[model samples]
Target: MFSSKIVTFNKINFLNKLSDGFKITNKSHREYFNLGHPLESPPTLRGSMVVEFKMSFILDNEEFFEYGSPVDIGGLSAGYIGLENYKASDLKVNFFDFDKIISEISAVRFYERQKFLEHEITESVYGILKSNFNNDLADFIRFDENPHSRLFEFCLAGGYKINEDHVQKIHIPNTYKNSLLMKRISDRFKGRVLTFNPKYGFESRNVG
Candidate 1:
């Protein structure tokens, strides 16, 4: 279940708010980030951390939607455990405008350009998508590595490394455009993994 009220926030306060972690309940489609559950749970999320927010560029662009599908441009997601799996170059945390980076990395090809936009998940679900997308394991984890289906074969007894080619194809952020913001994010989250932002605290969608 989700609250019908739309949440809002600005980049500045949002950055500050994330320093304190939070939890979201009833998240759908991000079972990977929840710490203690057996992977059998469905795509729906019981709860998840809001480590990263993928702001929807399209939300403000009605023109873009006129010609293209009105996709739920972006949403929040977790980046803790999954981030560690990425190489420094792949992570590219300090080299991008968060919005631009996610857009490019999750280009149209990965998503069904038209009908896909109709289905949207909560911030927690988006967080799961973010984690997998950033870590370059979206496909592998979703299709090939069904840890639940093959618990012994994959989860307990198997191991694999990230495919360099796959990671190479993902987008790299442009640090020049937003270095200061990137620095703040990187510094605040440095050496910290598996943490998330509070679902409701500082302010969501606050305006002065």
Candidate 2:
């Protein structure tokens, strides 16, 4: 699904853009402003008037994926409505998967790793040892913090299943350390772990 949080500002210039107002210049101050008050007449006018508008859009997966560039939406060039004066916060959009995309990715990674190992250990005598290792790894894979509980349950329902019988433990060192196991975990969970910051807006298309 696709979602958007939009804020608009209504300013005097907006009326001018609509060709409903005349520009009145303050010659002494070298400044110009719109004279017409479309909503309220001059006698009833107060100081300057500003309005803020905020709207959210939620679209289905197909629509969301089809969103064109922001520039095509008129973006900042769209006449102010009052949105500029108000500070809009907490704008977020996340794509959730009903199917266990993370688990699928993890399973693929495990299969690839196992295939690589099988190619290296060519000796038939090590078949039993390899089988034991695979079983242990699969057990470890199933041992999440709470196996019964799903991550981001409220936002996205359905649970992912751990399929591997033998997976490696993630281990990292302080010195230029890179653990393949840790990388797998990060790749699987990165989408859920990262969040949009109010101070710095962010956007994500997928949960895995």
Candidate 3:
């Protein structure tokens, strides 16, 4: 039953067909990055920018008490809706390798290099190519920057570089390819993503 559907939310925008509701300053990651540092981090899962909707569904079925409780403003907007046929398997990442990289790199070098690398990457010299990929992932997790593009930009952020050749070699998993909801404007996913309404009940559109 839980596997069949997932809940998500969006900001009300003039262009949104289902855009309706009062906006609130949820302490999610989008605001975390947007608001900058020296602030208390909100206890929320998934930042606003990464998934423009609440993803408590990820923890909904856990046996632990209130695992997914106190989600922000659910059912408040027409744009606030549920996704049908959601699956965790659809989301993939080589987190094992990424976590390994995160652990292996020296803290000094990781923090110092803040610029994206421009050189071509090969399998043999992949480890030598550096631009703080680990720290960038940390920022992405803490902040709501658009995800590092797997194709064109290659780098995780400005200096965190990963080329096509090295990406395949390292087994850097494509995380968002099959996700039903990513930033719709980013062109990361094609079309046919669906949303459900809580108002009149249900309506879906191909969000391209």
Q: In TM-score terms, which candidate is top? A: 1
Across residues 1-208, which tens digit of lDDT does each residue of candidate 2 receive?
1111111123333323212224323322121111011111112222222211111111121122221210112212353211232221111112333122222322344544343222212123123223433433223223322221111111111111121211112111212113343244335433322222222211111122
Which pairs clash in the backbone of model 3?
9-53, 115-159, 116-158, 116-159
For model 1, residues 1-208, the per-residue Cα lDDT tens digits are 0001111223333233333322222223111111112222332221222232122222222222211111111111132233234342342222133334335334544333221222323233344455635424443333332232111100100111111121111111222213464444445555432222233321221212
lDDT of 3: 0.22
The sequence of per-residue lDDT tens digits that candidate 3 reaches over residues 1-208 is 0011112244333112111122332323122001001111221222211222211222221221111100111221232323223222222223243333323332225222211111112332234223323434233222322211111110011111111111110100124323443333223222423332222122211122
By TM-score, the candidates rank as: 1, 3, 2
Q: For each candidate, what TM-score against the reference? A: 0.20, 0.13, 0.18
Q: Highest lDDT: which candidate?
A: 1
* lDDT (C-alpha) at residue 182 in model 3: 37
Tell how far residue 59 is off in model 3, in angstroms.
Answer: 16
- For residue 203, give model 2's deviation from the true position in Å: 37
Q: Say what the RMSD of model 3 is.
A: 19.6
What lDDT score is found at residue 187 in candidate 2? 55
Off by over 4 Å in 1: 1-92, 95-98, 105-208
